[model samples]
Structures are given as structure tokens and as C-alpha cells.
Target: MSIQAKSERALCEITRSIRTRLQDVYGPASADSLFHAVERLIQRKRRTLSVSAGPRFSEKDALLITYGDTFLSPDRSPLSTLHTFLQEEAGSLFSFLHLLPFYPWTSDDGFAVTDFRQVNPSLGTWQDIQALGKEWKLVFDGVVNHVSSDSLYMKAYQHGDPDAEDFFIALPPETDTRSVLRTRTLPLLHEYQTTQGPKWLWTTFGPDQIDLNFKNPKVFLEIIDVLLFYVEQGCRMIRLDAIPYLWKELGTSCAHLPQTHQLIKLFRDILDWVSPDILLLAEINAPWPDNVAYLGDGGDEAQLIYNFTLSPLILHALVCEDASNLTQWASRLPPLPAGTTLLNITASHDGIGIRPTEGVLPEEARRCLTELAVRHQGAVSGKKNSYGTVCSYELNVSYFDALNDPAVQEPQEVQVRRFMLAQLITFAFRGMPGVYIQSLIGSRNNLAGVRKTGRARTINRRQFDLTEIQQELGTPGHLRQSVLSEYRRLLSLRRKEKAFHPDAPQAVLDLSPSVFALKRGGLPGGEEILALHNVTNRTVRVDLSRYLSGERYQDRLTGVSYARTDLCTMDLTPYQCAWLKKETLISA
Candidate 1:
């Protein structure tokens, strides 16, 4: 077939798939109008991209971008924030910008997507998102992992509407439903029920977020249409949130199941067949084995998987006061399939609880790690002294409480130092590190405000205040300056350092209980960089004669050069980090 013929065929198939999918969700007439809206959005995107075209986009050069309800500033300008962020921090490192679920919703930080076709007015309009997509690559949340029980479809389902009822997963009669559904994961929601009978709805997180049934082919097709619609709306990437829970099996956690991978692979294949430019990121909150599997053997599944393990490793090293845990984790990493990447981050809006690193630390140390996270989170809400005991380890806040906390304040310089250090470690470590916008400006958690609002997670979703951040930035010796400086330093090094890019795989060099060391090679230019971190509260020395045979190693961070074994007995200050680069083939 001619190239033009192939393009036309691909477009036609996508149109047909989208129409059928939308008809299943909405009626056929609504789907038609939605399809037209999508086409207009895509045209706008294409026109936007036409103005400043760079290198022609290839399939391999895909980026997974994401935004959330609280991802925006109070002014609700994710585009301007993203534009500045890409220009200042990311530059050309990323080709995609995923504006997370920005649509209007009743609860769960907009995860309960109310409208599939329109942008939430609280966030910018759909036009703003389309315009942003035009200038940069774009990704959006499928968020079909679960829908709000109060969602339009769910309401229809409750009202005995035949069409909308099939769109959601409903349990059997009350007695049969008890065998299949779970009531509450939270402390407060001990019981829940649906109108279909006395049957309890299966809620993994809460009563609000209802898990979708992927066993039903209708559900699969409906979500696939959502995917196609976003692609038509100019999204080049789609984030599959809470993917592990999509398919449930008896007597198991029902996460990251075999079918899950198959389904994601199917989505990947479809996108490849349709646009080739669009990518899927699987939000599978699983361990390394399960997480890595999402990448598939041929790199044909998820293009990006969250490096959920690595983020906690950064925090653990800081709190344990040793870098060894991080280095140990890095040592065990297997090589990833080509054309795949890990999304690494330190802190996010999501509550970082004890589950992520439960068994990773010694029992005695776990308490300290827990305390540090709580305190750090507490600091975000401007409630450093409210907790009474610093190491109390009280699982006090709820998910919603953290999101809505109005007092979510920025941390002080000392606190920001520890936070920024963790983030720097994230940046220097292997995989693509993500800097949460709140953390970048040293934004804090909201304590009193959340308490006032009676929402525990409110602090987690507080809007970014640029004016407050600007005022804080004006303070010469503030935490904001310190964070900004360290971030600039780390990001600048990442930009210049070839070892920290997409292709570099990490290897562990030292795994002592107190210190951690990592090696990064396979740079685009084939150069090698060695990073060593000291996690102990006191100085500790490690012999580098075994790792380095050269007479000297150059410190990438501090411009100092040392003879090979000089580092063998050299002591590192508490929480100090070193990045050294050398040619692999040095002649004697």
C-alpha cells in the first residue's frame, strides 16, 4: 500500500474504534459529537506543533508525562508551569507532558473522572490542554482503573438505565455479592452497599472509587475507545492508573495478574497499530519483579513503569543516615529491555506510607524511616510541632485529609536540605527522576487547613501558590533558595552528565550497611560515571582500588581529582555524595 493509503487506513480504523467505544459509554449521538470535538482538538494540536517543529518524532523517543488535580498552581495554569519546567529543568529530555486527570470530579483528587470528553473548569479548559499538546508531546490519564460510584455512568446504573448499567461492574444479588466484594480499606468505611441489592461493592481504596471489571469485554472496548478518543484529542501518552487492580482473581491480591500484562500489551499493540507515537504508562504499584514485567520482553508492553521501589530507597537512605540501602537496591537491578524507561521520583501527592519499604529495612530502623516520612510530610503542612512526639509513628492522616490540607506549607531550609538531598539522590540514581512541582518550590503540607476542612488528604492536593513561592524565593537565606540551588545544581549536572540519561543502566559497587555506591555506564557516548553516597551519621571510608584501577578519579560534583586508592581510605562526611567520571579503557 502507498504511504498515504496506509495513513488514511490507520485514521479510519481509529475513527471507527473511537465511535464504537464512545457509543458504549455514552449513546451513539453523544459519541458522534464527542468524536467531532476530538477531531477539532487534534487539528488544533497539529497546528500548534507546526509552528516550532524540531526533529521528526520517532516511536522510540516517547516520554510519559503526568499531571494531577493538585498538579496545577492556584491560577490553574499547568501549561505555563509545564512550559517553564521543561525549559528550566527538563529541556529536551522529555517529549511528552501528561496532564493527569484534570477533569471535574466529586472526590479523590479528580481520579473520579466525571466527564471523559471535557476538561475540568477548575483546571484549565480542554482548549488549554489541546494548545499545550500542540507545542509539546501530551499524555492523559485513562483513569478507568475505577470510576466514582457517583459518576454519570454510575448514577445511570443506579437509576436502572440499561445502557449505562453495563458500563460499570455490578455485583450479583446481595448474598452472592458478599462473597465477591470487599467493604473498606480505610478505618472509617467499615461497611458499604450498592442499590442493586444488599451486595457490597468491591472498593480497594474507598467507597468512592469503584473498581472496573475488565473480565467484561464491553469494559475493555469502552476503555479502548477512551484511549482512542484521547489520542484523537492530541494525547500521545495515556497513564493507566491503578492497573494492577484491573483484573481480580479469587484467593489472591488480585493485582498485577497475568491478564493485566496481556491487557496492557493489547493496548500497546493497538496504539502502535494506530498512531505509533502514542505510549502507555502502567501505574502498577508492585515490587521490582512485577513492575519490571510491565515493560515486557520485547519492550512492547508499557513504555514506562513507575520506579516505585527506587523512590523509597532515596528516602530510606536519608533517614537511615546511610546510602548503602540505595546502592544495594541498585546492585540487584536487571537490565531493562531496549526502548523502555523507569519513572523515578522522591515525593508525590500520594501518601508515602510504610508499605513501600516494609521489609526493606531492619525492624529497629523501620520506625525511624516511618517517623522521618511523617515528619517530612508534617512539615509540608506547617505542623512540625503539632504531632507531640516526633517518632510517634501514628498513621494519623487519611488520604483525603493530606490532599486538602490548606496549611500545607513549605519546609524550612534544614528540612528542605534533607528533602532536596533525597531528590538529588533520585536524580543522580538510575532511571528518569521526576521532580514533583510542590517539592521543587519547597511546598509544604497543609495541616490546620485540612483539619478545618475535615479532610485528611486535603494537604496533598493543595494548589501551588506561585506568589507564596515567589515571596519565599525573595528570602535570600530561605529553604526555597537552598532547594532551588541544589535542584539547579543537580539538574545542571544531569544535563551535562551522559551517564544519567535514558540509556544508562545502574550497577551497584558498594553495599556496606552504612555506605552505598553506584556505577552508571552505557552512556550515549559510552563514557562511564561512578557515584558514591555515604549514609552514615559519621565519616566512613571505602577502598576503591578494586573498582578503580586508574591513578586518579575526577569528582563530577566537586571538581576535585584523586588518585585511584586515595578514596580507599578517604572518609565521606555525613550524607555526602560523590559523582566521578573516567574513561573505561585507561592505558597504563
Candidate 2:
């Protein structure tokens, strides 16, 4: 076939697939119109937007996740201050910057978006965001599942505007929504006074946030336009927040519905046609199987999915001084396709979620985790399950505090080592690593902030003034400076090794219960790195010859060499990590 003919055929197939998904959600009668409207939007976007096919994902790619206002300055906007901090302190350590919901929001920090198209004036303007994009790829939050109740669309709905009549989901008070999954303890339906009457609206998150009605084709088109706008504004990636609850069905779980998957496939198709470089990241905080479902066959849905189970599993291993569960879980992970990979993150804007550890960790283990949080002056959040029981949902503590108890009068060096070991394990995994801003600086739990805000998540979301942070980082032997220095060194080393590629083969080795060991890269003569992490508070010896082949191996972290009898066994100190490479590969 001619090249033009092949292109036409591909376009036809995409249109057909989109139309089929539309028909599945809406009726067949409305499918044609919706398809035409979507096609027009895509074409217009292609004509107006100049999306550069930027560099693809690679082993060197790492994301720095933070809020736009995490760094404050008296001289400029928070966004600009963040840019300055990155340029001066972070340098080229991170390739992507995930700005968590910088839009105007009524509540929930920035999740309850009041305006979709504009940035929060308190942070900065579009130019400021674009400036940051020039230095590092930007990841914007697609808070499309719901909007603030005070948003214009909700206001229009309340005023009975025809254009916004079907923008939100509202039903009778006694609607049969018991099957709907709940992520929070708040009521699923909240009574709202609308122009029609006092109706109960679905609020998956809370009262201030109202769910959008995807049953209406207009709502779908509106979100599509907003996503395209994000790409046009220089967002290389979009994090779909609360995506599992996008499409609702009365008698079903209303989570991860068939329609939700179809809609995500449609989104992937549209993005593939218009801006092929832009990636979609699904933020599903569910069990392992359900979380991996968002990566639908590895190519048709999200390009990246959060490895929500990793954080909790790492915590469990380190706290219990055993790596049995962590090794077993890593060995069982299904192989990912070429274009999709997991985003390994140790911490984020929210707390350490327990929902992802459903089958991986036992109930008693989870109880111990929550108990540890309370002992460390942290808190826990709960959610309501289908059984009408309130269960612990997540542990609200900083990653540093979770690993090192502040009450224990240990040396700062010991605490830093233990904390960095947890982070190093995430970096050595077979996926791209995402570093939270607070983790880079070894921040502790902010119980005062939690008390003031009356929100458990506030324990880790403390903002820092730019000048104060700079001073602290400049001081010698400071905890923040020590942590940041070690983090930078490890990240730099990771970028130089090809074995850390997201698609590289990983073999989880069970050498000892106190050590978490994994080998990256193919077997035989292929380039590889043997990563060993000690998850205990005492010295442990591991037999390297049991799993490794070559006699001589060199430690990348320290320029120490092991050969002959040394290769048979090696000792790792408390919270020590070693990245071993074959001596021949190092010489080459």
C-alpha cells in the first residue's frame, strides 16, 4: 500500500475505535455526533498547537514530585522561586517536575479545582510554568474526575443554566449507591440546593468536591478540551487523579468500570493522534491487580501507573527487619510491555496508602504499621469499606519519620543511612524513580501542622521558605544537607548505568532475610548491576557466589574491589547499600 493510503487507514481505524467507545458509553444515536465533535477538536488542536516530539523515556529519566508552592520567596511568585531552587540546588538531577494541581482550588489543597484553565494567582502565571517547562519537562495534574462545588460549572448548574444542566451527577437522596466504593468516610451523596430542587449529588471525595457526569457527552468533550489545553500549555505528562472513580454505575462498585477503561483508551487514541509525545499517568491507589489494570494491555491506556504497593512494602520490610515479603512480591510482578512502565515512588503529597497492600501484607502487619505511626507522633486516615466498617486507609507520616523514630536519640548519621536505604531500594527497582521534595531533605513529621489544619495529611506537606532552606542546606553537617548530598550522588550514579533502564530485566534474589537483593539487566555477558540493600539495624553477611557468576566484582558506590575469596561472601553494615558491577564491565 502507498504511504498516504496507510496513513488514511490508520486514521480511519482510530476514528472507528473512538466511535465504538462513545457508543458503549452514550447510546448509538449520540455516538455519531460525539465522534464528529471529538474529531473536530483533535483537528483544531493539531493545527494550532506546535507540540515538539521531545526525548522519549530513558534510564536517566527521574521525576521530582512537589507542589507549586512548596518553596516560598518574598521577592517573587512561588513557581519562580521553585525554578530558582531547582536550577541552583537540584541542577540536572531530575528530568521531569510534577507540579501537583496548581490551579485555583476551593479546598483539598488543590484537588478541588475551581478553575481548570487558569493557574492559581498565588503561585504564578502561565509564563512562569512555561519557563519551568523549558528547563524540565512538566507533569500537570488532570483533576477531571471532579470539580470544586464553587466552580463556575457547578454554579451554572445551580442557577439552572441549560449549557451546564448535565455537568454534575445529582440523584434522589435514597438512591441505591451502597455498592459504590468509598475512599473517604464522608457520605457518598451530599444534599445540594439546585435550581431544580434540593438534590443529592455524588461526592466521591468530600462535600466541597462534586463528581462530573460522564454519562453526558458534553462533559466528556469538555474534559477532552481541557486535557488538550494542558498539552498545548507545555505539559509533557498528565497525572489523572482519582481516575478509578471516573465513570459511575448505580449497582456496581462505581470504580474501575468498563466505561472508565474504554474512556481511557479513547483518550490514549486521541493523544496518540494529536500530541504523540505527551504521556498519561494513571494515579490509582488500589490493590495490585486493579492498579495494574489502568495500564490496559500496556499500550492503549496510561503510559505509566503508580507503583503504590512499593512504598508500603519497603516500609514493612525495613520495619520488620525482613525482606521475605518484599522479595516475593517483586518476583511475582508481571512483565510490562515496551511502551509502559511503573513509576516507583516512596512518598508523595498525600500519605502512605494502605489500600495497595491488601493481599501483599497481612492484617496484623498493617496494624503494626499504623501503631508505629502513632508511636512516632504521626496519624492515620481511614475509609469505609462495603461492609460498613471504617478501616485504616493510609499512614500519614513523612518518609523519614516513618523509617526513623524521632523519639529515639540516635545519631543523625544513622537515621540518614536508614532513610536513604529505603529510597535506594526504590531507585534500584525496574522502573523510573519519583523523588518527593520532602524526602530529598530528610524532613520529619509536622504534627503541629496537622493539629492546626485538623488534617492528618498535613503531617508531611510542610512548605519551606527559600532563604531558610538555602541556609540550612549550606550549613555543614546539617541533616538536610547530609541527606540532599547523598541523594544527589546516588541519582548521578544511576544515570550513568544502562542497567537501570525501566524495561531492563530484573531478578529478585533471596540471599538473606535482612537483605533486599536484585540484579538488573540480562543474564550472561550483558551489562548488569547487582543491587544489595540491608534492611536491618545490624551487620549482615550475604553469599554473593550463590547468585552471581563472576569472581571479581566492584562496588560502584565505593571504589572497592572484591575477588577470589571475597566474592564468596560480603558484609553489609547497618542500612548499607552496595551496587556491584562485574570487574570486566567496569574495566571496559
Candidate 3:
């Protein structure tokens, strides 16, 4: 088929898929209007690369996940300052910079977006984002699940405007919403005193944030336009925040709804048709089952789903000094498709969620991890059930602090080692690894931030002064400097091997309870990379004969080679992690 003909056919298929979804959520008339809006927007959006498919991400494609305001001063624009810092601190280390929610927000640390089209004034202008994009691959946040109650769209709903009447979810006082999943303990029905007097609006996340009604086709088109605007502005990947809750139905869990999955698939189809390079990464932080649902039959939905189970589970493994559960869970993960991979991250803007640890950690083990964080001066946020029982949801603390419990009073060097191990294992996981600002610089919990904001999540979202960070990172033997050096070394070693590609084959090796090992390779012409970690204080012996067929291997982290003696068993010191490359692959 001719190129133009193929393009037309793709457009028709996309339109058809979107129209069907629109009709399912709304009715025929709204579906037609929504399709027209999308068609016009797609036709007008030019400049996007018309590739057949996006190239698979590499181990070199490590992402630095941080807010645009992460590094700044009172005088300097945060985004511009961030660009400067990356050039010095993390430039070549991570290929992509994922700025979490740069839009103007009313609450939830920018997750409750007040305006999708405008850049937050404090975060600098679109020009700043473009500047960062020029220097590194940019990943923008798509906070489409809900909008801030202070937004203009909510104002229109208050005024009962025709086009915006159904933009938000609102039900009568007598309505039953008990089955809806609540991320917080706050009342689900937020009492809003608007121009329409008193309205009980659905607030899935919080009172300041209002759930958007995808039942309104106009809302879908509005969000679609915002996503396209991001792509036009040079975003290679757009992360959909809290996406599983996009569609709400009464007397149901209001999560992972069929309509929500349909909307995601619709988005992937339309966006890939427009620009195959722009990846749709779904931020569904549920357990493996619900989280895996976003992958959509292994192909059509999100190109990447955040491996939410990794961070907390890895922490649990290290805390308990047992990789048995982690190894068992990881072994069960099925192979990913040719181009898609999970987004493996150790930490982010929010706290370490326990929901993802449900299947991996036992009930008692789960409680212990949360208590361990609290024992180390961390806080726990809970969600209330119908019977008024509060269950722990997320542990609010820095990843470094979470791993190094003050109750045991681990030494500074030991704390740094444990923290770095957690971050390094993410690289060995079967996905694209990401580094968060707090975890990257080894920042401690900021109780001042939590007290000032009155939100537990702020404990780990502390903004650093670029000057102070530079000074501390340069200091020899300091915790920050130690963590930074080790993290950079991990990234440098990871990038040199093709076997570390996001889609490369991964086998979870059951070496011992005190250790976790991952093997990457086995593909034709692929280099075998072996990762070993000792999560305990005492030395543990691991036999290399079970993992490798070679007689000798080289450690990439340290330039050293050892000959296999007595079937090649090696002992690792406390909290030691080694990146081993096959002699054949390294010398070749």
C-alpha cells in the first residue's frame, strides 16, 4: 500500500476505535462530536515523527524521576536550574528526565492539576521545558484521572454550563458509594458549595481533587487534546497518573473498570497512529493482577506499566535479609513483548505504597515493613474501610531512610550501602530503571516538609538547593557523595551491556535467602550479565557454577578477574552488590 493510503487506513481505524469507546461511555451524538474533535486535532498535529514503531528502550535509557521544582533557588527558575544540575550531576547517567506534574495544581503535589495547558509559573515557562528536551529525552506527566476542584472546568460544572455539566462525578446524598476504592480516609462525597448550592461530588483521591466523568465525551476529547499538546511540545513519553480510576461506576470498585481499560487502549491506538515514538506509560500502582491489566493482552494498552511491586518488595527483602519471596515473585513474571517493558523505579514523588506488596509480602511481613519505616521516624498513611477500620496504605519516608532503620541504629556507611543496593537492583530487573531525586542524592526524611505541608507525602519530596547539593556531593566520604558515586557507577556499567536492555531476557536466580541474583542474556548474540547482592550482615557464599558455564568471570563494578576454583563459589561481604560480566562477552 502507498504511504498516504496506509496513513488514511490507520486514521480510520483509530477513529473507529475511539468512536466506539465514546459511544459506550456516552451516546451516539457525543461520540460523533468527539470523533470529529480528535480527527481535526490529529490532522492538525504535524511535526511528530511518523515511525512504524518505537525502538525498544535500552539499559542506557535510565530515567531520573523528579519534579521540575526539585532543584532551585528563590531567584532562579526551577526548571532552568534543573537543566543546569542534570548537565553536571545526572546528565549522562540517565537518558530521560521525567518531571512529575509541572502543571498548576491546587493540591496533591501537582497531581490535582488545575490547568493542563499552562505551565506552572513557579516551574518556569514552556521554553524551559523545551531547553531540557533539547538536552535530554523528556517525559511529561498526564494527570488526566482527575482535576483540581479549583480548575476552570470545575467552575463550569458549578455554573451548570452545558458543555461542562457532566465533567465531574456527582451523585445524590442517598447514593451508595461503599464499594468504591478509596486511596485516603477522607469522606468520598465532598460537600461543594457552588453556584448550584450544595452538591456531593465524588472525590476518589481527596476533597481538593474531584473525579472526572469520562461519561462525558467532551472530557475525553479535552484530555486527548492536552496529551497531543504534550507530544507536540516534544514529549517522547506521557505518563498517565492514577489511570485505573479513570472511569467510575456505582456499586463497584471504581478501579480497573472495563471502560478504563478501553479508554487506555483507545489512547494507545490513536497516539501510536499519530506518533509511534510517543510512549504511553500507565501509572497504575495496584497489585500485579490489576497492574498487569494495563499492559492489555501484552500489546495494545500501555507501552509501559510502572513495576510498583519492586520498590517496597525490594526494601522488604533487604530488611528481612531474605530474597526468597522476591525471587519467587519475580520468577513468576511472564516474558514481555518485543517492544514493551515495565518502568522499574525505586522511589518517586510519593511514598512507598503497600498495595503493590500484597502478593509478594506475607500479611505479617507487610506490617513489619511499615512498622520498620515508622520506627525509623517515617509516617504511615491509611485508608478507612466502611466499618471505620483504617488500613495502612503507604509508608511515607525517603527510600534511603526506609532502608536504614534508626531502631537498629545502622552505621552511616551501612545505611548508604543498603540504600544503594535497593537502587542498583532496579537496574537488574526486567525493565527500564528510573532514579528519583531523593533516592539519587540519598536525602533523608524532611519532617519539616511534612509539618509545613500537613501532608505525609511531602516527607520525601523535599526540594534541594542546587548549591548545597553540589557542595555535599563533592565532599569526600560523605553519605551523599558515596551514594551518588555508586549510583553513577551502576548506570555506567549497565549502559555498556546490550544484555541489560529493557526487553532482554531475565531469569531470577535462587542463590540464597540472604542474597538476590538476576541473570540477563540467553538471546542470540546477547551478552550475559550476572547481578549478585548480599542483603545480610554476614558473608554469604554463592556458587557461580549454577549460574554460568564459564570458568572465569570479571566484575564490571571493580576491574578484577578471578579464576573459577572448586566450581567457582564466591563470598560477598555485608550488603555487597556485584555486577559480573562473562569473560567471553567482555573480551569479545
Candidate 4:
């Protein structure tokens, strides 16, 4: 079926399933309550499916930038840099920008919600975000996955206020809940004590980030109100953080439970009925097949799901010096639901996590990938450790590690060639790519925060210095320049090529393990473009002569052209990418 038809069918299926599920959960007599919760979502999904077929980048509600604990002011604001940033990177391609949770919280990089209604004073005022929202696309987070232990609501729960306690999921005393539902961090929960003895808290991330119990209907109602409030403030998209772990069940991995799907569908339904324009993006980090579940066989559950598989796979291909990982990962990629899209990106606020595809990657390959990372960082642990002391001036260091690595050479240029190529593949893939704030400026982990606090991620989260970027503009061909320049090139290419648009169909082409290829844009009279990427360090001769007969090839990035029979053995340099287009086709 076509993308539109598929989307429509998916909407119908989701609406039907939601209605049935609600009835089952609340009984037929509770139809009003069910309708009250889901009617909007059903209506919104239908409306979203009926949009005009064109480049969605033109109509995107927002362009998300990573806004950590502090929103860097232009002189100080990394986001205000958008005024110039939009001209360079976005260039009217997107209207919305998602500022990942800049609110005060304890763990999970601010996923632990301490305050729902207010923006963290450390970042800026609600007024600052509102003003920024006015000029550009505005998207604030609805980190409803869990609340912080220090949250006001949690405090109320601890003080025995029944009404406030109702907002959270506080465990019963003397109960051990750790084994079934695991927490990301240990020490915080390792020694737990409440009014009840040795009671376990539901921590999908850390003890500080206590997972809220969605089972409690009250939790649903309150969060809904919170979502509507943000929507009312002109926010276009609300990113549901750590969505899969929202609902927990026993004897199963608490993440991505059936109820989690139901909860998202319900949220979508409500939004549809109330505000059809608002988009709900799910941060469900799972493997390809499993991640598709969040799309609800169409566009019902979430309008956008994070393409975690693509980013990691691209990184894997780059780091491992083999495009096989990219091809293998792409082969397993599931289609997106109609009307909905995937939030694709290589780097974000958080460290890379590669556990989702364990089922598909060979044990040795996984071990090798792990070893490569450790070897780069000079870390001994095999645990995908992000905290390493590898001080190679050639390697890119996260902000946290940059400070800790005393060996960092001054004028350290972040080794960004492979990383940029990795991100290029990510943006060109079948999804809406999300470029993190740090990636734009090639910001490395801040070692200053690490030296001061001894925490790497937090240090990496330090506000950036745009002035320094402009002043020390010392090196012309440095990694920072390469990153900024390549991003512009790739994003520019994506805009010119219709295949990179949200509506375009993506097909993985047959190629060697060292080469990754995909075809996009078959618009009539508009030339079809084929993308080939070489992930190997050594040049690989690709026999694409078989597929190029009677065709002309043009490079999308540099407008370089070649005849179909010009060559049989195309030599690709290490970490190089090429876009081949027909000379007969119109160039954007």
C-alpha cells in the first residue's frame, strides 16, 4: 500500500484497538471515561493522515536542539545561536525545535522530573523559552516517564499527604521490587529505606528517577492536564521521554510492556480529539522490530519514534571500519507507520547505548565493538564504559572526558571525519534527523565540570562558549570546522533530495560489507538518487557498474558527475560517502 493508504489503515486499526482496550479495562459502562481519554487521539491521528504530500521539513512543527541544565545564551546562549544557526543548518527546513528536558532533575540526564510546570531556573526562565518559541519552532519536553525523589510531589508522598502521594508510585514498605524492574544506577537504590523496611522503588533509570506508576488512573489524568497546558502555550511537539518503560509488569522486562503501548495510544487519542496539530514523539529506545510497536502498526501510538537502531548502526559502521554493521542494521529496520516519522540522530544529550540490537549482532562482533571503544578510551572494563581516559588528540572527547584527560593537546581538534560520515548516513536514512546542539558546534565533553565534580556526563553537559569558538577560530581545517561544514553539506543535500524527505520511500540496496547503499527519490522526471558510503579505512573497489548501466551519476554534495560506464571499480576512500544522481534529472 501507498504511504497515505497505509497511514489511514493504521489509524483505523489503532482507533478500533484503543476503543476495545479501554472497554476491556474499564468495562462497557465506563465508555464515557474511555472516550474522554482517547477521543482526541483518534481524531488527531485522522487529521495528521490527511496532510498534503510534500517535504515535511517545510512544514515541520519544530527543530529540536539539546538544551541541558543551562540554556547557553548566544554570547552565552548556544540556542540563541539559532538565529544564525537556522540560516546555516535548518534554513527554513524545519519550523519546530525540541529543547530536551532542561528542567531540574536528579538523574537520567534530567529525565527524572522534579518540576512539571516550570522550566529549570538554571537554564533560563519560562519566558526565555517562550520568547525563543515565538521566533522559531518551540518544543518542550513532557518527561512524564518518572519523577525525581526530590520532586515536590515525592516530598508530599513522603510526608504522608495522600493527595500529593497519589501523583507518584511509592512502593509499599518491606517489598523488594528491584529484581523484576531494574534500575539503571545501583548505589542510590542499593541502600534503600523508607517507612517500610528495605522497600524497592521502581527505578527504570536510577533511584533518583522513580518511575511513576501509570497503573494509577490518577497519574494518567494529571499528566494529560500537564500535556494540554504545554500545548496551550504554543508548543508544537511534546517528547514523551523513556516512553516504553512507562508501564511495568512482572515476569517480563518492565520496559515496552503492552500497557506502555496502550498508554501512548491513549495519549495520542486525547491529543487528536483536543489539539490535532500537536505532535507526540515517543522516546522508545528498542531494537528495530520492537521499536515499531510504538508506531502502533500505523500512526496511532506516537507520531514519531526515535530511530535508535539507525544512529547506533551508523556509529558502529564508522567505528568498526566496516559498512557491514550499517547494512545489517538497515536490513532489520522496520517501516515507519503512515503519517508518523522517526526521530533520527547520531549524538544526543546522553551517551550511546548499544544493548538494543544484542539479539542480532554476533557475540564476537559485539565484543570487538566494545573492545574498540575501550581501546580508544584506554578503559579496561568491557561494559561499554563512557568514562575513559584515552586522551588522543585525534579522538573526539565528550565534554566530561575532555577535561579529565590531562593529555589533551591545546587547540585539540575533535576527530570528527568518521563521526560526521556516521551522522550523514543517519540523516539520509528513512527518518527525520535530530541534530544535537553539541554536534552542531563540534562541542566536546567539558572536562572542566569533570575536574570540578569528578562526573563525566555532567561535565559534558556544561554550557558552551560560542565566543571562544569564534575567537580561537584558529585552525581552518580542524575537526570543528569539518563537523560544522559537513553538517551543512549533508543537511543541504537532504533538502535538495526528495528521498531524504519524510514522505519519500527508503530502500536498502545490495552492496558489499564495506559499502552501504540506499535509494531515494523516484519522483517522475525528478532523478532518483542512490547513496553509497564506504566505512573501511582502506579503499574498496565497488562493482556498481552492474546497477548504473544506461544511467549518469552526479554527486549530491559537490555536484560531481560521471557516466554510467565510466568505471566498474569505484574506489572509495575510508569513511567516504557519495550520492549518485542521473544527469537527465532536475537538480535542486
**Of the candidates shown, which would achieve the greatest TM-score relative to the real structure?**
2
TM-score list, all predictions: 0.76, 0.97, 0.95, 0.82
Model 3 over residues 1-588: C-alpha lDDT tens digits?
Answer: 998998789777767777787787667767787777777878877555445554658767888899898888767899989988888887698888898988999877898888998899989999999999887788999888888999989888888788888788778977877787777888888888767789999888888889888887778878888888898887888898889888888878888899899898878877876887778889986789889878887587898889989888898888888888888999899877556788888788888889898767899999998888889899988876543567888889888878886557667888887887887788888888988888888888898988998988998998888999899999998888999888888788888978888777898888888889999876787788788989887888988786667777788878688666742688999988887876767855
User: Which candidate, 1 or 4, has the higher lDDT?
Assistant: 4
Count of backbone clashes, every candidate in sequence: 39, 0, 0, 29
- Can you write out model 4's per-residue Cα lDDT over 1-588, one digit (the tens) per residue? 897798678667656766776665445776567555545533443433322224334213225566643333444344345344444544554556777776777765667778888776666666666666676656778888888888876776666667655454545544444334332323213234444334456665666777677766667767877787777566777888777778766546566777778778777776664555667887755556777777785577788877766654665666566667667667766566678887777656665445555565666755654555444442212121122222111122352232223344533332455566666676667767787767666665565665776543453355645445544333577656666666666676576666566756778876788888887655454446678887766687788776674466777776777777764567777667887777766545
The whole-model C-alpha lDDT of candidate 1 against the native structure comes to 0.61
lDDT of 2 by residue, 1-588 (tens): 996798779778877888888898888999999988998998888876764456567779999999899899999999999999999889999999999999999999999999899999999999999999999989999998999999988989999999997788888888877777888988899988887888789999999999999888889999999999999899999999999999988888889998999988888888877877889999999999999989897467999999999999999999899988899999999888668899999899999999999999889998999999888888889988774678888999999999888899999998899889999999999889999999987789988888899988999999999999999988989999999999999999889887888878999998998999999987345589989999999999989877667878888988798884785788899999999988888755
Clashing residue pairs, candidate 3?
Answer: none
Clashing pairs in 2: none
Candidate 1's residue-wise lDDT over 1-588, tens digit each? Answer: 997898778667756755655565445666677657555545544433322213322312324334543334555466565554445544555456667677778787778776677777655676777777766777688887777766776676666666655554544323222222222223212233446644345565567777676765556667767777787778766888877767776545456667777677767655664466666778765457777899986786887887877765666666556666666667667888887777776555554433345446566665655455455454211111111212221223322222223235533533554565566566666666665555555555666667777755555445544455556666787755666667667666666766777676677776466767777766555657777776555677776666775667778788777877676666777556788766343323
**Candidate with more favorable, higher TM-score: 2 or 4:** 2
* lDDT of predicted model 4: 0.62
How many residue pairs clash in model 2?
Answer: 0
- TM-score of model number 2: 0.97
lDDT of 1 at 448: 63
Rank order (by TM-score, best first)? 2, 3, 4, 1
